[model samples]
Target: MLFDLTDLRLFIHIAESGSLTRAAERMHLSLGAASNRVKELESRFGMRLLYRENKGVQLSPAGEALLIHAQQFMQQLERMKSDMQQFSSGIKGHIRIFANTTAVTEFMPQVLGSFLARHPQVNVALEERLNADIVRGVAEGTADIGIAAGPVQGQGLEIINFSTDRLVLVTPREHALAGSGRIAFADTLAYAHVGLHEGSSLWHFLSRIVSQSGQRLELRIRVRSFEAMCLMIEADVGIGILPQSAALRHSQTMGLALVELDDPWAVRERSIVVQSLDALPHYARELVEEIRAGQAPRAISPDRNA
Candidate 1:
């Protein structure tokens, strides 16, 4: 109950390694010391959290629950250390961010670039995840911040308006759908499509829409980036549903065309999620502000960024 940070850390190390000896070596502690520390924890809990046998140590139900909370504890401790360092001369803080593909591709580059320019001592680790995973990760303390598109049932998170992500139909300049101005997602089913990678959020979203349309969306090619998808579309491989910001930027240079999507879901809004802004480390707060400043708002919202 009154375990120090070291106890929690060592237990986590042991849980990860699944062996007392290996964990002791990793922690630079003797096997006897590690064994004693684990015994003390078992005494505190009044239960055996781990079962040892031939291969390695395995967690009981209690150990499994403790591992979850212990990981969260480590994340918070790291954030606390980063926050405290801000009080010293230089910033020297690291903020971890998990964001969906739209945020990473269309928004974060310039925002993070400007933030790093202003705060040289701060660093960031960013991962592109699905919108659902982004929400869950931030809520579970896996990351300090989350950038996701569409409405989030944040449970008590502070949701700040980030940006509007529009999905438009991109095609060659002479394609029939190119000059249609706006078209339903289902209408595109008859034509071949240049799709993003299978794991990408856009690809999943498009796949679902195409499935729901009850018509086959002929797949011509798959590319990793929006630019690549656009290039393939330009070469007449097929049409693609791409982010408006990306499609517009490349369409101008490649002389491609953009058509509005008739479905309401095609236009998505993004938001920044945090458990508590007031509780964030100072440098993290600054980083949030930097991202907020990059909000290229295409619509009005109650808490739009300044």
Candidate 2:
């Protein structure tokens, strides 16, 4: 049976609003026209989709199924349109990448800037995601590439060592911990902490570790980006744990002191993940080569507190 996208969208609106009249108003259609469209959908499906109620409407069993598929269909279509818009704008290629927060905030800007400078026809869509989500997105073809730290496990994915980053604790120059050159993550929990906002990849990662450490992270406040967290720390709001590179970079302008974390997990070995290198488009393969060429061992300068 064939169902139109417009009708499917209307049905979704009706399902969400629980009122056909409201759905009609939202879709800019008359109530009668909306009712007829729903009726037409029911006729095409050969089954009752929604159960009319005095209050509004409820989805029948068949309606629930249709709603699930309709939402998926609409989402896929929207993604297609977004990808196609790049071409319409004279972009020759599009690449989607999902990576961990550190890579997103610390590493990708220079890499992407250089790559885009060399390939003006290419466009990239990058999202910061947790390591597990990055692996899954690459494996499911939701993203063309993924950059995440190690302990990554996924079938049919080619993993290449991308870079290494260390997590360090940053504090104001006069904070109690600022006198120490190295401290364990658990020890930092004793003081008020500045952290990335909840639902951020770093937030989730730190939460998991705190759970494992059998201690709670005493978060005084949460900010959106690493630089914001650093600013908060510099203001003596709270101590923060961030990638070493970021801490060192911010220390140049801010009076923040960096203290190395004793925990082994503090050091992360990031990797570039792809379903298949050879299977990627020519432009994608070139970008991959660019990323690979950019990989090099970085030497950490002495911590400020040291």
Candidate 3:
């Protein structure tokens, strides 16, 4: 027997809501109309689809079997519709992105601003996460794209080099090392260092540098965020090595000084990562090009100006 698509939709809705009354309310249909649809479906199949219970309606064995296939079919149909809409509208669709804190605060604004100006119809959603989490979001299909300090390891991910950023030592203006140019890593390590927690990417980068130099980093306090590290540095707790983007944003306004690290590992490559290189959507490709072509230079250091 042939069943209407609307009948399948109604069945799925009823199964989801677990009540004929609630399903009718959700579909904005009269209770009689909703009941008729379910009755018609059960009659056509020659089986009991639902059974009334004290808590709510429960799907019968036959109903449960049909519900699974119905839901999958509906999802695929919706995806197809969305794809056609995007193609017909010339790259107008919602694109969700995950970025690190430094990228969100400093780098992304200019790039996203320009893109939005050019493609006014497209909607963009952004979330700030840790570098590792950003990579995971893209890999897990939670985000369409991601921007991070370095390429994270995962199969089926296409990582393209977009830019480079440097880590700088930030201190209060009156600190003895404030005016110094390119402060040696050894000198900074001698003093108490305000840094992020050991597990953080920033901490890992610095730890690797110190380990290679045959010295252990002396940590005065471990903060969970770049903002907290800056605040502690401002309070003269210790010096901090923070992303240049983050450092420059607050250094001038907060009356803090930023110095370059002499260590070789101070600079990091920033990249745009996507799930699949072969099956990228048109808008995704455009966004990747925009990121690579429009990346800004790293924040200026005292030595560069002097």
Candidate 4:
């Protein structure tokens, strides 16, 4: 016999209330109709679904299984309804957004929060990934939108200027290089460096820079975050590089010193990447436009394709 959603829902209601009378009131069905529905389900299954006792009714093994399936069915229906409503009034939507560490930790939060405030029915699931990974995600349709740091390494993607940040060298205030106003990244590599874990994009990016310069970075240790790296630097562990804002703020509190890097690549220009803006759904495009709106004129990504 074919079972319908109403059968499952009524079964769940009865299973929870343990009384047909109460379940009927909740479903607005008469007690007789509720009882008959349960009997029909039990007869079709060829087994008793509920065991009636003095205290209340309890699920038989078969009813327990049905309840599990019913809950899952209800959840799927909710998702279907939510997705369906987007077309008519944009009452609900889900967007897949990917970004690098800097964008995710610093800027994306505020931008997403503001967007969510304006569109309560829309939901976003964001992931922090390396720029390379983000590029791949956008191209392969794994992510609807991507925010990546400088020198994003793929073509065929529609790119827009997202934001700008600089990587500044941080050192102990009394360290020998502390007084240096501006230095090259290659020069900073001469000192033992405290950095993020090996897997982090910043670490990998720095490693690539040192490799390209034909010099070896003296990486002494790896920590988790900019603040943690700052703490290690405060202990005189080693020098490090961080975003300008993060470096300056932490240096003020921790007595660390910041130096501007002379390398042309030290200043990072981030971009928002998508396989094709025109291919995005209406709600996804809304999200993309909001992100574009938040950026200043200089930060607005240039048409990389142009």
Candidate 2 lDDT at 68 equals 83
Q: Estimate each model's TM-score.
A: 0.76, 0.82, 0.59, 0.64
The lDDT of model 4 is 0.79
Model 3 lDDT, residue 10, Cα:
80
Tens-place lDDT digits, model 1, residues 1-306: 558888888889988888989988988999999899889989988998899889989999999999888888888788777678774857677788998777788878988888889879887889988778888888887888998877777898888886688888888878888767569988887899999888787888777776887778889888899889988988999998888788777866785878888999987877889989999999889888878777774522211111
**Candidate 1 Cα errors over 4 Å, as ranges:** 1-6, 24-33, 75-89, 92-96, 114-125, 141-144, 207-220, 277-306
Write the residue-wise lDDT of candidate 4 on 80-151 in tens digits: 676677656765578888887666766678888888898788878888887888998888666789988787
Worst ten in a row by lDDT for model 3: 297-306
Model 1 per-residue lDDT at 107: 76
* Top-TM-score candidate index: 2
TM for candidate 4 is 0.64
Query: What's the candidate order when arranged by decreasing TM-score?
Result: 2, 1, 4, 3
Residue runs of model 2 more than 4 Å from their true location after superposition: 24-52, 59-69, 297-299
Worst 10 residues of 4 by lDDT: 297-306
TM-score of 1: 0.76
In candidate 4, stretches whose alpha carbon ends up further than 4 angstroms from where it belongs are 1-91, 293-306
**Which portions of model 3 show Cα errors greater than 4 Å?**
1-92, 184-186, 195-232, 299-306
